[model samples]
Target: MSWLVTGGAGYIGAHVVRALVDDGESVVVYDDLSTGSAERIPEGVPLVVGSVLDRSALDAAIRDNAVTGVVHIAAKKQVGESVEQPLHYYRENVTGLQTLLEAMASAGVGRLVFSSSAAVYGMPDVDLVTEDTPCLPMSPYGETKLVGEWLIAAAARAHGIRAASLRYFNVAGAAAPELSDSGVFNLIPMVFERLEAGEAPRVFGDDYATPDGTCVRDYIHVADIASAHLAAARRLADFPEGTALTPSTSDAGRAARSGRWSTASSRSPAGRTSAGHEPSVTRQVSLADRARELLGWSARHDLDDMIESAWQGWRRRHG
Candidate 1:
């Protein structure tokens, strides 16, 4: 079966495309090249340079490519930017899904895997989120993602399509040597880039309740996330009689649905209120559980390993 990967030229989507190709799966990429780079997608994979919001383009691409499954990853993801431009977030994240769903119905593609986010949890009161937490999204970005998941569920129930939403946390690390995100967002990469430039890596928020006042986060390697998507796709295929829809198995998404996982802080790279507070290590191990139960997957690389490997890769590519 052919897979249509929206935003396949962006960071996480690019890695997913590479993984699918490596596993001998056929892939067709749909990206507008707004934030996605043409060079980021591996050579030879078909690319449709269009937006997911454009139903005509989406329908044509899905039909021409014979795309049986879709992995929707095209959405505006910057929390701060979403706050600054809520309309843009709603238009891209919410309306975009509606357009894709309409196109999918028209084209007869019955299965979908959506890339949701842990930001739906906002700041919870509990540290470890299960799959049943009440959603309290803080930013327009998170709200859009939550709404996207809701749309998937609604469409599935109404149209008899099967779907799985994969909620992701701090998605870091690179899968291919040639594919690196040069974006200035995200803390780890920002730290690496600054340190590489011989500048002190800035840490944010040193005055919270944790050991290190800096906000603690559950960082998952992008590769593991891709594996989860693959598993979700497989599960949807393997389930008997076709289950209508299910939320992501990730802890944060679970918490959002069940109101169990709570506790949040504004995570930024430029340092929070204080510059000298101790680091607050994340206590949630949701992704690990997902790796075990959902995909039979395990993160072979830790944060330090990912950092060092990326550092070397950056040196090789840039230096």
Candidate 2:
């Protein structure tokens, strides 16, 4: 059965489509071309021009493509914009996901890989965040993601749908120049924008409790994100029939921080080491560990690799 990838023409979605295709899986691109570019879609893949909000379009695509699974990557994801336009974010992200879930249930598409976010854990106070961390989202965008996860979990329990929600941290870099993220909403691109204008990238709130007074984030490569989707899809497909996949910490722990961030502070050149904050005996191991154990997945790229690859893409577009 083929996979229906919503928002397949977008930056991250396009990467996911490519990864699925490379793995010999049949894929159909479903996108509305709102913030997504049609040109990002590869040859030999069927592109269905539609939105998740369009129930008829979603139904038609799933039925026509004989889709057995869905990799949902479509959603409004701007933190600041989500605050200003909370209603709009809810309608597009949460409501649209509900529509898609309904269409899936009707069409008998039982497997899903939902694109979630680290934003779900707003300003985490823990030394290491995991899947079971407290979810106190700070913005509408984050709330939408958490709600989406809840919806997926509920749907899975009620309808026997096998699903996985991948809570991605900061995603950066690209597999190719053309596939690089064009949006400036993310940190890497934001930095690129400042540098292109001959200005230093601003580090907000240097007085925070972090080691260097700057925030530390677990940045994963977009390519790694794509592979994680494939891994989750395969795991779901392999599950026994009549079994509903619960919200496993396996999917939630996909993007754990493997290393410390380097900073310009006097405390240490390379901030606190992973050894500094040892894993608690009572607390669970990292999400990355769970991912490796359950899905055979691990992130191979580091921060420097991500920055260098992103810089190449930036120069290709803005130079």
Candidate 3:
């Protein structure tokens, strides 16, 4: 069956599209190109340049392309920006998802693979965040994701839709240099930009009670994200209608879903904070236990691989 991938031209989206195409899936890209690039679309994949908010366009794309499933990745995804522009985030993320779901229902499409986030957990105090963890999101972006999951669940129950939500954190690295992330929002790219500017990488928050007095974080490779999406997409068609699942991690071993993975000062390239305080290191193993069992998916990249690939991408773009 043909699949429509929203935001397929973005860094992560491009990688997801490539993974799908490489797997021999018939694909179509639906994007507004706001933060996405046209150059990222695969050579043979047809692109429908439009916003997810436009239901008419979405309907047309699904109908004309014979889409039976969708991988929804288009959203306003910045935590800080979501705080500053809550209305915009709610509209674009929440409302945009609603519009897409409506279009999907109208077009008789029942399979969906939604891109959720660990941000929905919002700094949980537990050592491991399972699917049963209470999703107490702190920021607008995280709230939108949690709400999006709820929306997907509601639709699944009422409309016989089959869906899955993939929750992840700290996406880094790329499958290729050209597919690398161009934003400086995440930890790695932020460090890359700071060092390139002849300045020390800045680490925020110094009040955590951890060993290094720094907050802990979990990281995943973008390629892993794409693979998880691929796995979810392929598995959805086989599940019974109204079935729903949420996979919390990708690849590695057991992920550091709980707080305080390690001493930050030694684990990352941003060795020391500007004030000479020790930065924290992440303790990510691979909390994707559910993903492995449900979709037979696991992350292949490690922390070092993530950093090195991202470094390669930075050099290619900045040099």
Per-residue lDDT of candidate 1, residues 1-319 (tens digit): 7999999999888988888888888999999989988888888999999988898899899999999989999999999899999999999999999999999888888889899987887766666665576678889999998899888888887776788887767766677656666576876556656655555455445455555434455666677677777777777776533344434433232211101111111221332243554443334435346435755555554564445555555655667
Alpha-carbon deviation at 226 in model 3, angstroms: 0.7
lDDT of 1: 0.72
- Candidate 2 residue lDDT tens string, 92-163: 999999999999999988999899887887776675677678888989999999999899888887887888
Runs of candidate 2 with Cα error greater than 4 angstroms are 240-286
lDDT of 1 at 14: 90
Candidate that would win on TM-score = 3
- Candidate 1 residue 89 C-alpha distance from true site, Å: 0.8
Q: Give the runs in model 3 whose Cα sits over 4 Å from its true position.
A: 205-212, 251-286
Candidate structures ordered by lDDT, highest first:
3, 2, 1
Q: What TM-score would candidate 2 get against the native?
A: 0.86
Provide the clashing-pair count of each candidate structure: 27, 1, 12
Better of 1 and 2 by lDDT: 2
Cα displacement (angstroms), candidate 3, residue 233, comes to 0.9
Mind giving the per-residue lDDT tens digits that candidate 3 earns over 1-319? 7889999999889999999999999999999999999988878899999998998999999999999999999999999899999999999999999999999998889999999998887766765667777788889999999999999999998889999999987788889988999888777787777667655556554566666645555678899899999999989978999988888875444232221212222323434444554443333223567888999988888876777788889889999
TM-score of 1: 0.86
TM-score of each: 0.86, 0.86, 0.90
